[model samples]
Target: MQEFFAMGGYALYVWSSFGISLLGIVYLYFEARKYHKKQQRLVRYWLHRQSKKKSS
Candidate 1:
């Protein structure tokens, strides 16, 4: 197991790369979720305005 992790002394580079990639994936997920929620809110607001206009 130690040898496997060592990666022939390139362990630091290899491990850090994996950590950075994981963080990027997590960041993208949250960003996408936030964007989706914002879009939904905008859509709902527009629909509400249209309904109000129609009623008036």
Candidate 2:
């Protein structure tokens, strides 16, 4: 068990590399969702304006 975490004396490097990669992936996921929501709101607003123009 201890040996598994030790990673043959390279534990710090291995663990930190994994942590950075995980953090990057999670950050990108949330950022993408935020951007998507922003785009959706913009599109909805544009459509609403178009409909109002057509009605008038």
TM-score of each: 0.92, 0.92
Regions of model 1 farther than 4 Å from truth: none
Q: What are the clash counts of all predictions, listed in order?
A: 0, 0
Residues 1-56, candidate 2, lDDT per residue (tens digit)? 99999999999999999999999999999999999999999999999999999999
TM-score of predicted structure 1: 0.92
lDDT of each: 1.00, 1.00
Model 1, poorest ten-residue lDDT window?
A: 1-10
| Residue lDDT tens for model 1, 1-56 | 99999999999999999999999999999999999999999999999999999999
